[model samples]
Target: MTMNEANTYDRYQRQIILPDFGVGRQQKLMRAKVLVIGAGGLGCPVLQYLAAAGIGTIGIADDDLVSLSNLHRQVLFTVHDIGLNKAERALAVLEQLNPEIQYIAYPKRLTVENAFEIIGDYDMVVDGTDNFSSRYLINDACVLMKKPLVFGAVSRFEGQVTVFNYRDDAHDEPVNYRDLFPSPPRAGEISNCAEAGVLGVVPGILGVMMANEVIKGITGMGTLLNGRLLTYNACNNQVYELALQVNRDARVSMPADKKEFMEMDYDCLCGVGDKGFEIDYKTFSELVRAGDIAVIDVREAGEVPAFDKFDVVNIPLHQLSRELSQIQAGIVVTVCQSGQRSLVAAGELASAFGNSKKIYSLKGGVLQWPLLHKKELS
Candidate 1:
């Protein structure tokens, strides 16, 4: 054997020895190209294994920065990586894990304008994002491009994994994410990892599972999770598999063509838009400066770098319901450390005050303000 061939075998000798997965499957893995969205909790493990398994070319797309809080689950980063872009940081580490493969980092958020372009180059896509807007956008892009997609999500102690837009030899029809949930959930209808909190191991387990599906899809070895959703509860160690049926009507809700898809506002459709009372830092600043607005910090007491620029009341989200009488302003803005809880607080205020008060959640929260609007801060 040539030195190159010997080296390649040495790297993947373990799996290659399996009864079904041999040198041929390893070569298939080396030839596959996969794109993973969101380099956070689930993305970290997924990227690691895929790289170690020698996927020929892998793309990492994420616009978020690594925070100290992410170290607990996003094992790909360290304290030194704080404030660095997640996609870029993940690429650096993944390259070290397996230098033989190619790694591409798109250090930007995947939007309607770029989703199609970025996703079109890859043979498969993996959804590891935490929000509904990103999930729907990625799903629609894969559906439009006819690329297979592996989806995973975590909440608190439980998580779910499924494969979409993939047809096995036995199945004539393929199912996408929308077939499982025809429409996006309303704002505040579901809480993310930040709002609900999660055990680090939950995503670790689900991410590895996602990588398994990707391998299965490429090598055609094991049975893929096509048309099936698997749910796992970390606390009780319980697992359940639900058969997913293709909803023919689900495609009606998606964009009809690339033009319509590009024009679609996933944020608005997924309830992260103005309809949900989510405002950027600039808008929040304007509202605060306009006066007659009650700025309520929904973060728990003792949260650092407090918002002292203006007079604000400290009302934790859990206590907001009991203290609704305390807020007497016509316009209310809720603030939190990372913006997740503030959205929930805004939803609560909307329900309590109805049309009487204009409730808003500061998007990106306090931590993101300085990074997004440095000039405004100065």
Candidate 2:
């Protein structure tokens, strides 16, 4: 039970040799339990480093299977792991890397109904998920359960890392993700790694940064990314830290007597707040075909199969920011497969081009586009 005990400092000797993270800190890490919400790109490095660093227990929560595309960034899986459950593959890797750590593959999505179950056991929770629904859920769960959340996110050439709900004797305020970003930018505003094409090591860098933050929180040694956001632009190899403060103006307005932690329609919440913003599909299509608007299809090259072939211009969301000068402007109509990414793209474009330009995004995306009975296949 002591710091200098046998077999204790042996595994974590390298970390213990560091100035701030010595034997006492290594012991804290070994005694800590960390729950990572995804086993994808971000989760892989987080779980691997934490396990190797001697974190006593790690819970991997995700229900997704490894796809050929995932191998580009999700380092936990290999050619043999293709089609296998992400959490399952990750657990096997962790077991091989560090048998001393108890790695738990929850092998299920973190829904509102069950987020608290596994999250409650860990010393800190890491939001490694890559969706708005999951991100909002993680943030709310942390706020409700009073758990510290170490967050990481990545896109094509950018990554973000931050700590939320962290406070000790000196600082008692709990800051959630909502406090930093206020709301999810409407879909399409930000592109996913799948759509935007992220650098394989982007998540690795951010993930390790997240692990460092969690360790900092446990030992209370250095300045955590608490109330601060660290943005890494791989394209430029630059790291910038932005100050984050509780936005009184944007505090989530919730019902006081709202009982139970049922899923907070993040799409709806995100719709109203800054989180991916756009109109439903029907209206967006109407404007695009009206011959008076410019339709921007913010989908990747081969993602989701282009829904509209009729006159819509293909400007993938990640490239849209730079390709705007090339957009044929009539009143712009932004759309994607499900409308999520398009909306985000639309919002970002509007921010740059002002709102009065008559730009609109598809609501339901092409998937939600209504099919006429006359077109039914016999």
| Candidate with maximal TM-score | 1
lDDT of 2 by residue, 1-378 (tens): 446666766777777898877777877877888899998999988888888878888999999999998887788788999888999889999899888778889888887668777788988899999887789878887777778899999988899898988877655886677677676765555566765578998999999999889878877888899878899998899999987777765564532222445735665655544433466544554554566667777887777655544666788776777987876565877878886677677777878788657667777677876665113311
Local distance difference test, per candidate? 0.90, 0.78
What lDDT tens digits, residue by residue, belong to model 1 across residues 1-378?
221578878989999999999888998999999999999999999999999988999999999999998999999999999999999999999988888899999999999999988998899999999899999999998888888999999999999999998866766788888989999877975778877789999999999999999999999997999989999999999999999888989888899889999899999888765556888887877887787899999998999878876778999987888999999888999999888899889888998899999999888888887744644543
Give the range where candidate 1 is weakest over 10 consecutive residues by summed lDDT. 369-378
- Candidate 2 — what's its lDDT? 0.78
Off by over 4 Å in 2: 1-9, 17-23, 252-260, 272-378
After superposition, the stretches of candidate 1 with alpha carbons farther than 4 Å from their true spots are: 1-4, 276-297, 302-315, 318-340, 348-378
TM-scores of the models, in the order given:
0.82, 0.78
Clashing pairs in 1: none
Give the lDDT of residue 372 in candidate 1: 42
User: Cα RMSDs of all predictions?
Assistant: 4.9, 4.7
